[model samples]
Target: MVVIHDGYFTDVEGCIKENWFQIDSLLAKQILCRFSLPFNKLAIFTLYNNCVHLSAICILINLFHIYILTRKALRTTSPIYILLTAIAMIDIVSLSYDIHTEIVEVYKVFKVCYSKETDYTIILLNNIMEFIRNYSRRCSTWLSFSIALIRTLIVKYPLNPKLEILSKPKIAFYIIPTILILSAPIHFMDIYKYQIVFYDENFKCTQFPSYTTLYYGSILSDYYEQDDVWLWKLNRTIDAVISKFIPCILFPIVTYLLVIEIRLADERRKKLNQSSIAEKDSKNTTKLVLFLTLPFFLGELPIGLILLTKPIDKLREAIGFSLFTEGIEKFFSVVLSATTATHMIVCVFMSSQYRESALSFIRCGVKFKSQNS
Candidate 1:
């Protein structure tokens, strides 16, 4: 059992001292005497392996996007096409730091660095992680908002009546600004609220500070005063509404309405001029919306309910939905994967034009390499 001090776990200094001494005496010597060089080499290999794996995947995805946009043969200049690129760009940017950070942390794991500079790196990395988190959350909100608004417009107003007027990037003009404005509040989430914990083999970060730990530490005890507690609860409540329920409800309703409008439009078009292609397009759109959005709704519901209600039953339900039985760390990862998968699937599947372009690009590159040989 340990106490708390300032904003950190109490006795952390002593704990770190004991751990470092143990590392130096037991693990360090053993590692050095038997397999130090080989171990270091292996760590480097693993680091490179992970970096290359992530970087390569990102490159491939981006290359595919580029191919689709550039290819004249499959030029699809639709609002949905633009949305796909926007989502891909977000993923690429988010992944750029994420992959590198993972690689760096993995490398550090083999040879731990606990100096002031290490702390700085940790701070920088933590901030980047936070930025990525907020950025991703904002992206999700915006994506849903955009799609919902688009569907709303298409359902509310047919394009044929005002075809020329609606073609001027209606979605981008409105949704972009709304998302930017709505996401502004997230920047206020400071690093000071939570203390980082190094436990077991890896450091497990927690959003909620242990009350016992906080009470022991003056800084944390002061930080977690009644006012702060209320604020935190309020913020959590706001997040539940803004990030989860609103988007979940709005997206489905808008999508349903849009589907109905599409069906109606198809019927009208068929009566006017029988075209199987238009019918196929409507079916594809319906499928695309359902496939992309259902996972998000499923993933968020349990977590959102738990957070909002905080009932034991609800919390247990959320835990059941969690991917791993390993506790909070695994829970966070599960939620993240589930949420991001929605965006990823939508971006990839929505634009068939992009896929064709990407495949052709890959083939050409392989051909060029073969010819060089």
Candidate 2:
């Protein structure tokens, strides 16, 4: 979601065309130097053009699949199914947040007439949006990681009765809530780091004396001055280290270990005269984990690195590098959104039961439509 903020100022037509959208002279100078044009606008336009409709359709499809998956998981009391259902639910929430924020942002960019009160409300909403976006995104990540961990346990400890208890829907319900509650505190840092500022009769919402502003002047300068600036920076560094960097490193390691365990189990099964139903289920779960994890790793790792680096003006000074970084950010936003949106499709392909349920649901719909006609 922070990635999407790069394009938030693209609608400043004055800044783009005539450099007339004055905030504070210092702020304007920092903005003009750091925030480039056409690329941001193009990224925003391209997102609306391509991702908006696709995301809407995917959300619908995801809801349908989530319904089927939830029913199946509850009926079967399958941990893997429950985890998949949880992932689907989180994806839906994340996608909804993205859609809502994008719509609000587009309105701010093109339609809303800025008033002091209106700007205040928008800024508040933006902060709330960032909170939800980060919260849901982290929840989604942890849920996926949980899936991989559960599957690894299943593969490695097939005979453990205690581990089998994890498959129960009641246990899954507990796990989901526990994950959500634990991850909530990490994102409180985001709320502290961002706030609304009013300048030159216009309200702007941004990080306190953002990297660009700090680059242009000392921390004590008129526009860049904020008593809590160091605290905010400290919080951001801690957040990046704990939330982004740790997970980025740990997820891949866990995934790799899961893959190895799954493979070893497969080989053991081959030596047997017959594989148990649980063994078969483990294989399917492994496949699903691979599908989900690949997209998450590819999409999130670079975004994490970008956030961790927090490119300063010196780094951004390279010719075309700023635009390039913006493009990378936008590109991964699409990837992450697409990955979340198409999750049901991944499940449908990876699990025969899901595919069959989907087909049956479609048939029922068709029959109902024909009867109505």
Candidate 3:
């Protein structure tokens, strides 16, 4: 191994001091060789495999969820159910898009069906799907917060019609559109932030690129771009606020308020000796709100806080882009997928109305199959 320092070929380990820490070339080589697998391949492989399994399960369960939710008994029950259905549908679309992007990535990463020039159309479609999935995740986040706040308000003020406007599907007809409009810009810039650079088919990505090895496409993102640094920072600031800061801050406060209201509601029930089935259902609905909203908050809270910390110069400079930020993003993407998956189970376990509807749907399905048979 050759070690070059300050325009001089040296075999010494003493001059390898960088900033605060000093590391020998042997150690550095060892570090690089230990993992062996290139990050580009590792990140994509891990994300692709996990997303395939998790997204498949989430899509199937959410399809069943939407079916059960649209039952006549549950459809008109409340706007909360409407929101739940929207979340489920978006989850399906998002996961499908994720799968689409990964499929293209398999071609891009593993160098399958190579051509003279890079497949811009395929790569662009992959980027579009990535952005759309991101937007869907954000919309899901905001919708979760909306439901939490609405359920809390309805519980806190049981008789306030104006405040409960959002709790009604008719009154809040624009909510979904509003969320889509607001969160659309967050990923718009990201589309232009990356593009495929490595295109040559015969050119080995590394010394000898084969299966389970170096990356095929090496696209640089905005964080690596040196031009217009201020603009990137400004855009990232806005993204952090819209996509991370506000929702993360408000979700916990809303959760606390919702939990408090649930307890107070229980106390009210005890005081009134309200043992009626309707009162029992009301209590269950309140708990359902907690169950639905809390998962997204918990799943996203860690990553949100970490992303928020990117603005801090010291921390960001200390931990460079790919290893820390990219890894975290991939991990949390799966976390969000898993969180959405739990919604089906959450609805089934907590909402008695949903349980009844699910049973009815199951019976209808079995009867129809028997008749067809």
Tens digit of per-residue lDDT, candidate 2, span 1-373: 1133544445444443433332346565446535555555655457633576666776887788678887653338567677767877777776776577668768755743445566567657756765786788788877877777777776678789988876666667778999989988867656555545544343343434232211111112222225534555455456566656777787778788888887777777688866776566557767877787777777777767666554344334432345545656676766787777566767777776666666667787453221100
Scored by TM-score, the top model is 3
lDDT of 3 by residue, 232-312 (tens): 566667676777778888988998988898888889888998777776777777778888876776557766766666655
Question: For model 3, what is the C-alpha lDDT against the true structure?
Answer: 0.67
What lDDT tens digits, residue by residue, belong to model 1 across residues 129-176?
Answer: 756755665575566557555545654575556644333444454555
RMSD of each: 12.7, 9.2, 7.2
Model 1: residue 297 alpha-carbon error in angstroms: 1.9
Model 2: lowest-lDDT 10 consecutive positions: 212-221
Score candidate 1 by TM-score against the native: 0.61
Q: What is the lDDT of residue 261 in candidate 2?
A: 84
Candidate 2 segments whose C-alpha is farther than 4 A from its true place: 1-45, 48-50, 73-75, 105-115, 202-229, 276-278, 311-313, 316-324, 365-373
Error at 224, model 2, angstroms = 10
Q: After superposition, how far is residue 174 of candidate 2 from its true place, in Å?
A: 1.9
Cα lDDT of all candidates, in order?
Answer: 0.49, 0.63, 0.67
Off by over 4 Å in 1: 1-76, 93-101, 160-174, 190-228, 270-273, 276-283, 310-352, 365-373
On lDDT, the candidate that comes out on top is 3
Better of 2 and 3 by lDDT: 3
